[model samples]
Target: MLHPSLAFEKGVPSDATAIPMPPPAPPPRPVDLPGVAPAASTGETPRPPERPAELSRSAPAGPDAARPAQTVKEDGKAGPSDEAAKAGETVKPTASGEIPVPPPRPADLSGSPLAVTVAPLDDSACRARLERLGARFEALPAISNGQCGAARPLKLTALADEIALTPPATLVCETAEALARWTTEAQVAATRDLGQPLKSLSIGTSYECRGQNHDPDAKLSEHSFANGVDVMAFGFAGRATISVMPATEGTPEATFLTAVRGRACDFFRTVLGPGSDAAHANHLHLDERQRNAGHRLCQ
Candidate 1:
């Protein structure tokens, strides 16, 4: 028994002397992919790009790396600016395949001083004939400054609507003379034919030399601009007739108005008569804007 116990003690000493094994070599790290090393991830456990998008291998990650890392081709090319590539919409290039340009602004319509176009030559012979006919003006002045740039033009248009007369601006002087002449002839002829002896030819209105339709603080009227005029009527035999919008049916007051209005077409650019409108029911509306612009015959 004593011998047996001694032998067991000897066996353990041999095993105790044996060398220990190294830890299992870590599984060889999986091979690294070509480029897509995980980007500087803002850690949300990256959704692992719907596709592990691979950019141009030649174009590496850098300042001039075409575009943002996540972005693909824009319009089949690489660029910055949102305009270069709209988000939810397709950019249709022009027929020439050029980028579309914006339209010109209203400010661009302003004529340049250096490129100003001189007005066409004036007709001297016509001017002389008009001078003999008591022609009053060479050219009416342009709109005043206080008036709105846009609104003042409307005044010119309104006057045109009144006259039943649309003549070239160059012929406006002759047009005015003709207007005055016809008005004179009508009153005279009406006096002769209607046996309406002359009394007083009152002026209900005339060119005021102001802006159009604007009676600003009663400070200025389009008439004041000399762009408009108003006529009250002609005096006839026995009675002074308020002829413009004469409500009296079939009388010389009415006939004279009718004839004058009919003839007015030949004079003014526009013509408003007694039957034309309520505002003009008391007077004639006349002016020259443009031939065939907007002619309203307001009584």
Candidate 2:
């Protein structure tokens, strides 16, 4: 029943006043990520978002990039980190990319210069060596008279293993022991090889109280102290005799004598034979005369 111009829209109340709706909520404001610049402030050019500080610190860098600086203490000195010290590890800066090496340890010597020990010399060692060679002799009183003396003398009555002598001789124990070894190991062995088993030895001179070659004015001979002995000839079981002389050369007897004389140097300090001098042209002379530096006189 209202005029056309004044008629309300279909469901509006006739008495209601006109009300304007609030403007549509402002479009949601754009959210800005951390470290990102606002779009309005930066104009229309879209920029890549910046990473956070923690992410940047963890990211790996290129080989040519500068390394992070080491942290210095407040006292102004740079040192290893606490974790590295606790782990017993050190980090050293490379110089020209070269690695560092530690020095080698020294060897332990235990206060000794040599690895082995040597036993001290004993006085009875000589007698022990002689007795082990099966020599038969009685110990005699020592003789001493003005540069002419025999210490620990023994009356040597036999040579090789019970082989008796035609006349027993006297000599110092050292010389007697040497003679015994040379006779058994050298002379007897060589003669037996020549088909002559010796039974007895002929005595020449032993314990002579004289100078060299019986010269009264010369220096005392080794014989004056019962240290030298002479072997004139070797007697076999059937009364066979082989004299030690150059005349017997080229014969088995001469070979036997030469073999024995050469080996005597091993046992005796001095060995004299037919070619030595006119005085020793007929017999072999053996003695134990201590020389400097154990130099044996084998003539």
Candidate 3:
């Protein structure tokens, strides 16, 4: 019942005024990735995307590129980061990295110098040094009194260049060495200020098992251990004796005394002279008593 020109295709309704066709699918769309170029129609494997310009610049380049980063350690070494240290893992440095060196800790930053425990004294070596310094000394039997005595004492009679220790000093080798070294300096001061070379050291107390300043209840003196000496006066070859008592200001004796007392501090851990205290007003007291943190007593 339809004309040849108006016949509908299969599945179309015969009574419809017009018929609709299914739309064709859109052409395949190319992906638009961030920081990536659109694929080329040529399709040469669509070259792999590159790192963004900003990201590429963020990496370190050139000679230091391979060097490992450094972090400060608590002990003042340069090594790994704190997190790495906490994990207890060892990170080997890259070939380009230098071996890390620990920096020296400054004394002021630490409030004091590093603590060094005193080593046991080497007696033979000390005696050899004493001999080389031209001191005449002999070992004395060990003296052991209650809370006082020298384990290895020495009888020191003279110092370098025949400078006498009047009444022979009973001391330790270490003390003798200190005295000899100090005497050498004294001789220089004598010639310069007093116009003569030192002839003798009028020794007051070399080794006595008594309390400090001769007090019966106070702490024992360094002399109890043969570690201290009291120089009552300095005798020169031809100049008048200069006692340790106070001298006239601006006089050569005063200048010499000041210079020698100051120099004694360099060689002795303790140096007490006139004006230090009533107990030590008449003589120069030099000793090698070790104190905490290398503290010195130079009053």
Best by TM-score: 3
| TM-score ranking from best candidate downward | 3, 2, 1
- Select the stronger candidate by lDDT from 2 and 3: 3
TM-score of each: 0.41, 0.55, 0.60
RMSD of each: 21.5, 26.9, 22.3
- lDDT string for model 1 (1-299, tens) is 33444545666434435568899977765667454445475633345436334531333346644553222243455333344344422334579866454333377566765666455335466456555654334443344455421211221111111222122122234344555566556655576557664444445545434443443455454344344456566544476555555557766566666777777666666566556656566666666545355653323
After superposition, the stretches of candidate 3 with alpha carbons farther than 4 Å from their true spots are 1-121
Give the per-residue lDDT of model 2 (tens digit) for 1-299.
76433656554545454466688777765666354445786566576789886554332248723443333454556644454345444434478653333333356734557768444234266666666776666767777787787766777777655667657878876677778777786545555657757666777988878899888999888999898888888777654687888855586766777787788888898888888999999888888888999899999
Worst 10 residues of 1 by lDDT: 152-161
**Between candidates 1 and 3, the TM-score winner:** 3
- Considering lDDT, which of the candidate structures 1 and 3 is the better prediction for this target? 3
Error of 3 at 247 (Å): 0.6
List clashing residue pairs in candidate 3.
Answer: none
* Alpha-carbon lDDT of model 3: 0.84
The deviation in Å at residue 269 for candidate 3 is 0.5
Worst lDDT run of 10 residues, candidate 3, spans 83-92
Which digits, one per residue and each the tens of the lDDT, describe model 3 over residues 149-259? 878899999999899989899998888999999999998999898888989999999999999999999998999999999999998877688999999999999999999
